[model samples]
Structures are given as structure tokens and as C-alpha cells.
Target: MVRYSVLASGSTGNAILIQTDTTSILVDAGLSGKQIEKAMHEIGVSADCLDGIVITHEHQDHVKGAGILSRRYKIPVFCNQKTWDGMEHIVGEIKTGYQEIFCTGDRMEIGNLALESFAISHDAKDPVGYCVFAGNTKISVATDMGYVNAKMKQRIIDSDALIIEANHDVEMLRIGPYPWHLKQRILSDHGHLSNETAAEILTEVITANTQCVHLAHLSAENNMPVLAHMTVKTILEQEQFKVGQEFDLEITYPDKPTKLRSVRRR
Candidate 1:
């Protein structure tokens, strides 16, 4: 079985800790180096235990502390060439050996897990989501997506666990304090997913095999924890799906880490 935690999830910063019996991977280090390390320590896992740091894109909220964590721990950083090129300047210098570049849709083995990167619609050079395979169990992490297309949908189906973005409430964002141009960017195809869209996608992809779902990357200004959770819960229940009984539903934080979560194998 695989265990995971959303170290922090929101527009502010994002990170996730993925662990198996033998391998430990930190998905993204959007927070400061000390902050990421502190989050890991709070979860009872030392930063030294991490085998690698996998990046999703070049966005500051996704790679701010990536370079620091890698430099401090001598851990390898995995990202596509395009993403690496975009983030190189921001992350500062990293040794060539510690830079592991892979293609957008390529699958690579890291320690005790097989991780596959899939393209996502986001406002970045080459943003992607991750699918991690631990033995027969699968854990998928997908956030910062604009909208889910057919290919993206196919990539996320039939997972034991899922961490997906439920960014903002459409109405809230539309009427909120953000400027018109900013709202337009968020509502565009290359923007972010609203709570309803995230619910619709989750409802479509959730199979009987899926054990849990974590709603991530929420907009603190336009989204509330209760609203995001209830929106998805209501939609799923409307489809005759039992929210908690069938599979656990969770919310991630922008400032703090979520509790460790794992799926029970069938």
C-alpha cells in the first residue's frame, strides 16, 4: 500500500508527500525550504528521507522552494525539459546530476514507485499531472488544471487515490474583488477548474476501485472549505454515490498540511 499527504494545497503554495515502504517522494515544493521541511517534520517524516522532488510546472507557487529543497538534501528534481527551462532561472543553480528531465507523457521509475506524467491544461510552459504506481495500487495527483479534456480524463480514471484541484467557485470568482482581466484568465480554458467542474470530473472518473479523493488547490479568496466540500458531496450524492461510505472525501489546506491518507487494498 502507498501513503500520501497533501503537505500544502492552494494558490499560495503546494506540496505533497508520497511514501511507500521503501521510497519517499515530495511532489512539489511551492513553499519556502524551511516551510516544506517543517511540514514534513510535522507529519513525522524527515526531509532527508525524500528520494526526489517532482515538479508540475514553473509557476512560483509550484517551484519556489524546489531548488532549495534539492540543494539542501542533495535530492534529485524531476521535470520535463520545457518545465525545467522555464523554472531554471527562478530555482537558481542545481547540479547537472541532480536534474532528471523526462518528457511530458513519459513514465519513469523512481526508487520503489513508477511515476507517469500526463499533460494538463494550465497556463505554463509544459504543466502536467502525476500518476504513481505502488505495487498494484495507484495514486494520482492532479492540480492547477484549467479544464479536463478527453485525454486528461482517461489519464485519471480508476485510481485508488486522487488529489485534484477544486480551485474556485464560479459565482464567487465572478463577483469577487479580482479585476476583470484576472477573472477572465481564471475562467479561460487555460485557467483553473471551479468547484462544479472538479465535482463533475471526479464523478465521471471515480470507479469502485477508488478509495479516496482530496480536493486541492483552492482559491482562498474566492473559495471556502465548506463550499468546495459540499458542492462535490452534493453532486456525487445526486448521482447515487455515497460520499463517505463509498470513498472518503477530503479537503487540503493552503497554509498547513493535511493528515496522512492511504487506501485500503481490495
Candidate 2:
């Protein structure tokens, strides 16, 4: 069985743990090493048990603890060449042989898990999302994307579960306290995805075999969990899809673990 958990997600920090019977991997280590260790322990996994750390980009919320984790545990860190260049200094010193670079669209095996990285439209250099396969199950992690394009749709189509960004409500963001430039950036084509946009994308990608959706990367100031959940649910309902009956919807927390799930292929 393939099990995963969103250890933390949002502007402050982000991390995800994916595991099978024999292998465990961390998708990102945004939090401090101590925080990541405690979170892993809460889920009954040891920090030392992690096999590798795969990074999405150089953004602080995504790479803050990656180098430390890898160095401390003597585990490999995987990313594209561009990401390594952008994040190397911030992640501090990683020993030789601990850096593994894989290009976007390339599928690589780490233990029993097969992972594919695809480009995402974001401000960070070489930002991407991941599709992980274990046995018959597939889980897609697509956050920090400005908008969902056709290529992204195809990449995540029919996934057993998906963790996608629902960063903010457009109106809230527009009227919120953030300065004009920052607001404009977030609303731009290469910035974070709004809740409405994420809902629209879900309508196209979600299917009978898709079991769960986790709304991630919510902005504490511009989005509330209830608002994000209802917005997506409303869109699905308008599409004639029953919320709980058709699939489960959840929201990831910024400060703690949201949910632990085991996704099985249909």
C-alpha cells in the first residue's frame, strides 16, 4: 500500500511524506530539522528512516530544511540542475554523492517508488510538481502553480489522489493587506493558483478513479479553510458531482499535519 501525509503546507513551510512497505521518502523539507523530525515521529516514522528528499524548487518554504535533512541522515537530495543552482546556498552544505539531478519529465526510481517531475508555472526557477507511482496507485502533488494548463492536466489525469494549490480567493487577495506589486505577482500567470482556478482545474482532472483531493498552500491572510473547501465543493456540485459520495476533499494545514491517507488503485 502507498501511504502519504502532508506534514505542513502554506507560506510558512511545506513538507510531505510518502511511503510504501519498504521505502520512505520526503517530498520537501521546508520546516526545520527538529520540526520535521517531530512531525515524522507523530506519524510513527523516524527521520532516519527517510530514504531521500526530492525538492520542487528553491523557494524557502520548500527547501529550507532539505540540505540539513540530507546531511544529517546521509540521504540523497533530488532536483533538477537549475533548482540545485538556485537553492544550493540556502540549503547550506550538502556532501558529495548526496545530490541527484533529474530533468523535468524524466521518471526515476527511488526504491520501489517511481517519480516523475513536470514543469509548473511559478516564479521560482525551474519549479515543478511530482507524480509518484507505487504498484497500481498514483499520487500527484501540484502546488505553487499559477494555473493548471493542458499539460499539467494530462500529467495528473486519473490520479488516485491529488494535493493541489488553492492559494486564495481572488477578491480576498485583491482587497487584502498585501502591497500592490506582491498582489499583482500572485494574480499573474506565473504566480500561485487561486481557489476558483483550482476548482475549475479539478473539474477537468478528477475522475471516478480519483479518490481524494487535498487543497494545499492556502494563504493565511487571503484564504480561510472553510472558504477554500466550500469554493471547490460548490464548483464540483455545479458540475453535478456529489462531494463526499464521489470523492473526498480535505484542506492541508499550515502549521501541522492535515491528514494521513492510503490511496489504493481502483
Candidate 3:
């Protein structure tokens, strides 16, 4: 069986736990080590047991705690070479043997999990998402993308579970307190995905194997969990899709870890 938990998500920090009986991994370690450890322990996961910390990009909110975790646990950190170059200064210093680099689109064999990287549109050095295969279960974690492209849709489809970014509500973002420049950045093609776009992506990519979908990387100031959920729900309904009957939809929060979502192997 394979299971996942959103330890934390938002602009403040982002981390997710993907685990099977034999392996345990975190997609990003954006939070401080203390915060991540507490969250993991609250959810009954031991930080010391983590096999690797896999990074999606070099953004501070995605790599803040990576160096601390790696240095403390002596766990391997896997990411693209460009990401290593961009995040090296922020993460400070990592143990020589623990820094692992792989090409953006290659299959990374880490313990019992096979992680395949796929490109995404984001304002970072070579951002990518990952599809993890654990036995018969496939779970894809793709966030921080501005828009869904043909390649992204291809990689996201036919998954057992998924974590897609629903970063902001357009109206709130437009009228919010952010400056014009920041607003423009968030709305750019290389910015985060809005609720509507996320729904549209789901409508195209969801398949028979998709059992659970997690809405992640939400904006605290520009979006609310209920609003994000309703927005996606409304769009999905318009497409004649039943939200609860067809599949389970969940929201990831900035303040706490989500309940463990386990994928039942068929």
C-alpha cells in the first residue's frame, strides 16, 4: 500500500510525505526542520527514517529546510543540477555523499519508489514535478506551475493519487493588498496556477485510476480553502462530473498536515 500526507503547503513553506511499507520520502522541505519534524511526528512519522528529500525547484519556500534535514539525518537530497546550483546558497552546506543530482526528465530509483520528473512552468531554475510509482500505485505531485501544457497533462493522467496546485483566486488577487508588480508576477505565464485553471487541468487529466486528488500550494492572502474547493467543484460539476462520487478531492493547508491518504492497491 502507498500513502501520502501534505505536511505543509502554501507560500510560507511546502512539504509532502509519500511512503510505502519499505520507503519514506518527502517531496520538499520548505519548512524549518523543527516545524517539519513536529508535523511529521504529529502524524506518526519519524523524520529520522526518511530515505531522501526530493526537491521540485530552487525557491526558498521549497528548499529552506532541505540542508538542515540532510545534514542532520545524513539523508540523500535528489534534484536537478540546475536546482542544485540555484539552491546551494540558501541551503548552505550539505554533506558530500548526500547530495544527489539527476537530469530533469530521468527516472530516479530511490528505494522502493520510482520517481519520474516532468517539467513545469514556474519562475525558477528548471522546475519539475514528479510521478512516484510504488508497486501498483501511481501518485503524481505537480505544483508551482503557471499553466498546464500538453506534456504536463500527459504526465499527470492515469494516476492513483495526485497533488496539483490551486494557488490563488484571480479576483482576490487582483483586488488584494499586493503591489502591481507582485500581482503581475503571480498572474504571469510563469506564475502559479489559479483555481479555475487547476480544475480545467483536472478535467482533462483525471482517469479511471485517479482515486484521490489534493489541491496544494494555496495562497493564504488571495485564497481560502472553502473558496478554492467550491471553485473547483463548480467547474468539475459543469463538466458533468460528480465530485464525491467520481473521486475524492482534498485541500492542503499552510498551518497543518493533512490526514494520511492511503492508496489501496488493486
Q: What are the TM-scores, per candidate, against the unseen true structure?
A: 0.98, 0.98, 0.98
* Residue range 118-177, candidate 2, lDDT tens digits: 999999889999999998799999999888889999999889999999999999999999
lDDT of 2: 0.92
> lDDT of each structure?
0.91, 0.92, 0.92
Instruction: Kindly report which residue stretches of model 2 are placed more than 4 angstroms away from their true locations once superposed.
Output: none
- State the displacement of the C-alpha of residue 99, model 2, in Å, after optimal TM-score superposition: 0.5
Candidate 1 local distance difference test against the native: 0.91
Q: Which of the two candidates, 1 or 2, achieves a greater lDDT against the reference?
A: 2
Worst 10 contiguous positions by lDDT, candidate 3: 257-266
Off by over 4 Å in 1: none
Candidate 1 per-residue lDDT over residues 1-266, each given as its tens digit: 78888999887899999998799998988999999988988888899988999999999999999998899889999999999999999899988799999999999999989999999988999999999998878899989888999888898898899999999999999999999999999999889999999999998899999999999999988999999999999999998889999899999998888887766456
For each candidate in turn, give its C-alpha RMSD to the true structure in angstroms.
0.8, 0.8, 0.9
Report the C-alpha lDDT of model 3 over 188-227, residue by residue, as the tens digit. Answer: 9899999999999999988777788899999999999999
Error of 3 at 222 (Å): 0.8
